[model samples]
Target: MGAAESTGTEREPLLGPSQAEATVQPVTNSGRVYGRRWLVLTLFSMLAFLQGMVWNTWGPIQNSAKQAFGFSSTDIAILVIWGPVGFIPWLLFMWLMDKKGLRASLLLTVFFMVLGSALRSVPLTNLQLRRWLIHGGQLLNGLAGPTLMSAGPLLSTTWFAPDQRATATAVASLVGYLGAACSFLIGPLAVPAPNDTQIVNSNIHWDTEQIRNRIQFVLYAELGMIAVLFAVVLLYFPSRPPVPPSVAAASQRLSYRSSICRLLSNMRFLMIALAYSVPTGVLAGWSGVLDMILTPVRVSQVDAGWIGFWSIVGGCVFGVAMARFADYIRGMLKLIAVLMLAGASLAATWFTLTCLTRLTHLPSTKATLYTSCILLGIFINSSIPIFFELFIETVYPVPEGITCGVVTFLSNLFTGLLLFFLTFYITAKDRDGKKQDNAALTRGLAKQM
Candidate 1:
């Protein structure tokens, strides 16, 4: 078969001759099987898992850095921007994925990840240097994030049959979340007990700088593993299976602009984007602020780290199960919307309770807060695989690279903007309270005068 073309406005049948034959032939009589494809899927899942594992470790460790550097809430907030900043390079690389192919892109991403992680271990003399190195590391990792996030769906679509695509994608995506969980879980264990309160209070002190060095060393090792996988992908990853001429020819092709225009013009994309963007934005903000928010509630740093770890665990389990259920019921869009709405509601409840708890000076409602957060994690993450599948199905048979790039770009862009705005809003609220307090003080002095 010639190179597969990009998808277009009109829907075309995805069933190649093999699929059609399978429908007609007895299941036992079918000559073709995809045993090798399963192997590829497993490899891709591991790559995704490794990528996520590395990326999420920073969240649990952020408080330690904050204490080390004496960073305020605002400074910490600025740190979160590194992810979106890193995304710029990530998106640029993704645009090239179609022309470059999966193996090349995956290797480049892993290289960046390794480089970033290694650089993060370098000791800096001052806060400025520390900020630069840390954020710069994050920037590189962000570039890798999109590649890792999209790799699974693309692999599943290319390798798996239509009937099995959703399940395959779910499993791969679930692995990524599990990797994130593992990162948080591992980070606390990796660090040593510190002498001063900085590490103890923040729950992030690398007992010795050696811990950071060890992480970098492990990242370098993982880079070698990625290189091995890249070779495997090149040798084994199927571009497209052999197919009949007619079916191959009929696969609709369109220019990139045309495909994008169709996607943009679709009302469904807008609705899904809006619904999906909210929880995504919330999660980004929550991940950044979770430690800070817990401070007032007097939750220990270790507990906070565990909370983050468990949140990812809940998200991974719930997201996978829900994605599978959506496939089973054939209600992918509905399931995504419902899950997102539920997440938003849970988040709203959590935020409201948090504010009340703060104002009332009540005992830290850690259990309630953590429970809500766990549910929030699950529901928020549930939308991702669903959204990914919907984008592919809705824009039937597009070159997986282009389709994934466009969808991820939109989701990341909006989510980034929302996070920025939300940060601004929260900052403004704090400033307003300070202003009110000052005004009351001035009024009292004026009355005495």
Candidate 2:
């Protein structure tokens, strides 16, 4: 059967296959098209948000977790590796998206996400067992990364009209960043600044009990939120519309093997992937080691988390706005990406300089850092949907699942590798004022606090 027949949508030949050629596009008998697509976008965006939260869960609270478990920075570093670790499953999930469609893929994704959180929240007297369970849980949750990350392009292409595709993709993708933003806010609030009320022979001491309780609270809270979202997804989210949303979607999809091969050979696609990969990977690496990197300057987890929150807010707002603007002015996709990326680079550079030097002690440092973070967030996030839409447009006829999935996989792989190695370079001053390994670095951080 042709694409139209398979999707239960009628089509008529138009300018080209690249252009949606449907004369009577998918609509209800009442002539209203995609009455539920917006709802669908909301559901998928929520999933994307949860995925981001789970991925960055350890970052904001790394110090508390370290003090609680006596964990090394390397152990915490591995948390970021979960994304790369899922690459094998990522390939399988993409195949599922192609062969079985979004419904089956979403089911598999949600299952692991919930299971992972539950396992992580599991209480065990044996610290080693508890640690391993947390690792196992993160691993399971990692499997959902590609699915949520790719949902923007997959759902946008499958549900929206050509005119609205980029904006939808942007909104969905931006929510994931919003999740990360919330993680930063939630992290510090969950584990508030250590109380410095105690004075023992001219020494200020921390309130450790409060930190432990906060960590426990954050874990249970995360599990509760995941449970609620999981129930909603199981009951309401559809795999796809009964009728195809666009002529491009009504057409048969390319084989997974062929899609991969085509992507591998496409220099433009690789370039686009590379352009996105570098800044995003650096950002990921920075977020993972944020506490460690800022340790010397005495930046608290709450401060780090708040910075992240502001950045994400900037990213989400600009990301959606930029995507809508790109849709309005259709042909300048490459130009938009370039300008935004440059802005991100500048912001990251400025933020780095401010933190590295004692410039943060200067009166204007906080304002500078916040502004730079917001700009960095805006530039990096705003460019993502542009890249997603460009990738699909450049590689016409290939499924959005494959196009977006490959890019997500590559970016994640790069991020994981970058973060893994970046952990090595992070050093801290011990109680005796000597530079030491990450394990000692945690102790150093504790002493400083």
Candidate 3:
């Protein structure tokens, strides 16, 4: 719960010039074995994937979730925001990791995720009660978010050789993104498509029975997956290997507060963190509202889901390649991050304007939207692993988990603020327009979809 300070007298060397070089450079021969680190990476990566699965579950199915519970766009948006809102828990859990080590923190994460999944799936007739239960479930799962997000870099540092850390982290990150992509594909696949006539009549709004049935099907599958993973993690995963896999990981860890202070004082770290915060927050917030943004364009939920699917696919392919290249080159991390962010920003801006202008019917415009989504995914998501690796590189000797936790916490705060305003602004605008053309828009919207 509380962090203990490492006094100067008791503290290990703060990873100065000599120590930094020794830890970060490759020491092992090309043929050297990596021991059980690979197995550990696999286990943590599964956790990352499962966390991704639950985090975006409602997003791909946002429309169904909204209809099933009769929630407004604003109300459903709150569910997505809960994950970032768990920033407080993020700090506590990261501290837990630093104080208690990986196994305790990881077990804690699994417990919250499983318990949350079970609670969320509780079938109840009272709509409001069911909504609250699901909200509560989401908040619990949110507590696990920081742990999973930060764990890849930390795990890589702990369990990989210097040359292997970037690729290992990239692979772990890839699976998590893969889990998210599957959610987009899986959410709609689990729910039968609305009848053509029903879609034309009511804008793809399924009957409550249909919505509930689809949601139940997905929830049960999610629960089953969680149960299996829980067993796997508990049985085979260790707190750590008896031996340290890398010199960097074997180095002394700074106290939590001290690490925070160090990062705060570092101008390069602060600058990069600020720049990195924007795309990460924007992309995540935009993902949550994708269905709503596409509503006026009449993009069917299935089509919108496919857009997400392809976007994440792009992220996986490019993300791994970029990370591995960074590992090989071992420089230009900042320049690479900047170029990726620039590309993503351009793609995102182009897509935003097209969607807002209601240009979906234009063949060229639709193609543009899909292309931009994938490009945005590739650029933004690929940059994530690079920026994280750069963060550790810049602030050597600071434990990967703590620095990553700090970065995630701050970026998520920005994300929450962006979502808060975006939700209100869009919701208010939509509400006002609906008041004037309620009947005509309803019919037209249905036909458009």
Best by TM-score: 3
lDDT of 1 at 449: 100
**What is the TM-score of each predicted model, taking all chains together?**
0.75, 0.85, 0.86
lDDT order of candidates, top first: 3, 2, 1
User: CA lDDT of each candidate?
Assistant: 0.61, 0.75, 0.76
Q: How accurate locally is residue 237 in candidate 1, as Cα lDDT from 0 to 100? A: 55
Off by over 4 Å in 2: 1-32, 195-209, 358-364, 426-449
lDDT value, residue 386 of candidate 2: 84
In order, how many clashes per candidate?
1, 0, 0
| Candidate 2 lDDT by residue in tens digits, 1-449 | 11112132323322233332333354432121366889889888888788788878887777777777666677777876786677666778889988888878888888898899899887776778988988888888889888888868888777776566778889987898788888888887767544321122435344656666677677788888888878887888888766565566567778999999998999998998888877776676677667666655566677778888888788889888988887667678888888998888788878777766655454336578678877888788778888888888788777888888888888887888786666564423232245346568899899999
Clashing pairs in 1: 192-207
- Give the per-residue lDDT of model 3 (tens digit) for 1-449: 00111233222322343432342332333212246677778788787787777878887777777667777778767877887887777768888989898888888888888998998999999999998888898888888888888778887766665666788878875677777788888987787544531356565455779878889888888888887888887887776644454444566778999988898999998888887777777777777667666666777778778888889878888888988887777567878988998898799877777766645443435677788888998898888888888888788778888888888888788878877987788689878878878888888999999
Tell me which residue pairs clash in candidate 2: none
Give the runs in model 1 whose Cα sits over 4 Å from its true position: 1-33, 69-75, 89-91, 123-130, 192-250, 358-364, 418-449
lDDT of 2: 0.75
